[model samples]
Target: MSGGTWIAVDGGQSTTRARASWTTEDAAVAGFIQTTDGFAAVAANVSAALAAVPDAPGTIDRLVVGHTGLPIDHASRDRLARMLLADHPVREVVLAPDEVTAHAGALGGPGVVSAVGTGCVTLAVDAEGRGHRIDGWGFLFGDAGSAFSIGRAALEAALRSDDGRNPPSSLVAAVHEVFGGSPRDATWALYQMTDRIDRVARFAPRVIEEAEHDAAAAAIVRHAAEELAHACATAAEALPGIDRVAVTGRLIAPGSRLEREFIDALAARAAHLLTVPSAGSPLDGAARIAADGPSIYRPLVEILTRPESSAA
Candidate 1:
């Protein structure tokens, strides 16, 4: 049996994934934990996930962690390292921002990865190991073209239209259609029932669909697409050695105009375009990282290109 195992912990804003793989097998073990409160809660989740794993820490040769909102300072790194070390007695550990792992998961080797969810951001890593980032400003100030941004705009329009402050919007109709008869019910579901920004963001697509029939919603999606494209193109231009760009988001639905535009921008900067329809979960990506060691690029490529399982 191989003496070493590779592990990857990927923490997102809403959840965390932990993966472990033995070097000898193509298979990997993985688990997920949702983040209910915030970073501290996520940290506890990670601790519990690690504890539930069968593998002992000393057997783990290397550990790689990617967490959201980890301050890139010495104290922050030290604290996280301490947390991981508390449970896993690995010889080496590599910690990176969750965005970096998202880039790693999406682009695999070296390229730009634009993650558009509740927020928008682009990160590029050239073959030379250089990195560039753009447009990760918080929701109020920036995050243009993000789901939340689009949803917020659409919601404002819907409310305005309902009160006759603006023209009647199909957006209002779409929202009404999506959430049963009452706009109040939908609003409560979004604001009161869930703290999930991404869930709230889902309503943006309805706005996009309505845009074909409603000018206000259309303008919102168009502006969002434009900004998102700009972010992708900017990152690609700043980084060399990037021939592939991976775009991930609920907004970039297949066959949708948003996907077309995002692809066009990436294609403008890179030679190959791979839209992520089957890229494995971050947990699987993490397993590949754990089993492969230093050659993260090749292992990641294999994981991403591999056919996805049909059964859940």
Candidate 2:
């Protein structure tokens, strides 16, 4: 079993977070750098992220990561593990798709987890260890009830009002307040930004805030929340008898509008499914997987150790 110094990497599209247990203490770093470039770039990005973390131990017992864009095939996974093993003073490396880690972090058992942040994904696992994923198709294809979708809808509503194609909305004024231009100019500014998704997603809170008193914003938020619930339900449907559901990220925080609406919608659609609070972040899940996770997650997470270390 792995013990002592451990490093957990949460490699995401928008930011990378690395947490490590030091020889004498614990240290963590949240470096706001995009880390997921694909299998070819994962090792370097993971290395860069690990370097950003402060106060690392000279040697590490295990490196656990829930990385975006990690290949699912066994050969690619082994190659990635080898690359990581070569770069760090680690005895073992556990690599998995970020979704698996998120699921483990949230429920840690048979349940459905819907993660709604800049992007969104719903994953479900049953008692038999069968898993199915829903949404997470990225902004262009789907990501149905994600922050990007809500923000884009808010901006579109503002532009629609400007063009008189739809009823006037307070979001038009909000567009000017945020982008300091007409609705059309706001659209142009967004299109010109180097990080369009982050820029757009930043505006989601404004939309959610206005949802309290604005019809247009409320409509968009309600639709997105309902869609999020639907996505979670769809994922849960594949899990057979599992009825537990959990949500993670800023959108689902306690009393947020999105969280409230999502819970209401979920109750309406799947009354038997219970929503539970997440145990921790994906980084925590990586640590759990590294230490050899519960039997339910064994089929989903792979813990790879050096032959010599395992033989010991």
Candidate 3:
């Protein structure tokens, strides 16, 4: 391997982690860094993430980052590469949508990886490794069954109860406890903040916690499950004959309420499908790509080197 130092990052909406591996003629060293989350397209967030890495190996010989909010197109991905290259000392950079890495990490071959965390993104790769993305559209437009969607829905339910437009919900108390006394005021304040989506998404677990006794919360979780299942079905269809799905992210973690809901929903919609555990986390996928994984993934990422050279 042609390596001085190789760094791989998995940047998500909730967390950012970096791993640096350095090798010399006879010595090797490695270290790790973890930081708060950042939007994938924003340079400042990416820079902050990279800066947190401790090793200074002169220049990072190779860097691969799988991040949220990155567009799939070559121009947009390369644009992000350029921005990161300008800030960090690196010989080559590869940028891709976090789902790409999630898919690679979860299932190295032909299958679908439905990543449901603070955000939701699903990717299906055919036998040839051609990938089709489904429902990673962020909070504003899509991200159907994401934590943001569930939290936002629960907030709306709480607001409805507060407004006397709906029946009393225990979620109203949750709102009061989590967002101060007034639901409307706290929600308005959250909207004013830049991290509104993250703030809203943080409420998902509360809603899930109340699903056992709160009718409104149960309804919200049910709908969220339906949406998540739909995305999984779509991804599975894209994979041709794939009958099982691997999932990543915190939302559908093992033994969680949302995980149970998502599994039931998927069973209802696609009875033939099976829910499979992910082989590895997104970070594992990022490292594989950084090390040049199977050819199927090569076309899905944008790689930028020194000078004007860009590779597909």
RMSD of each: 8.0, 2.9, 5.4
lDDT of 1 by residue, 188-304 (tens): 677765454655566777777776768888778777877876776678778665555666655676677667656665555444544455254344545545555435343222121
Q: How many residue pairs clash in each candidate?
A: 2, 0, 0
Instruction: Extract clashing residue pairs from model 1.
Output: 6-290, 7-290
Worst 10 residues of 3 by lDDT: 24-33
Q: What is the lDDT of residue 68 in candidate 3?
A: 77
lDDT of each: 0.62, 0.79, 0.77
Residue 29's lDDT in candidate 3: 19
Q: Per-residue lDDT of 1-312 in model 3, one digit per residue for the tens?
A: 343467787777766777667532211112112224222435555666666767565767778888775654667667778877877888788886789889888887778888887788888887776787888887778998888899999988888999999999998899889888678987989978776777888889899999989999999988888888888898888767787688887677788777888889999989998888888888788877777643588778778886636321
Best by lDDT: 2
Residue 20 Cα positional deviation in candidate 3, in Å, after optimal superposition = 1.8
Best-performing candidate as measured by TM-score:
2
TM per candidate comes to 0.73, 0.89, 0.87
Which should have the higher TM-score, number 1 or number 3? 3
* TM-score: model 3 vs. ground truth: 0.87
Can you list the residue pairs that collide in candidate 2? none
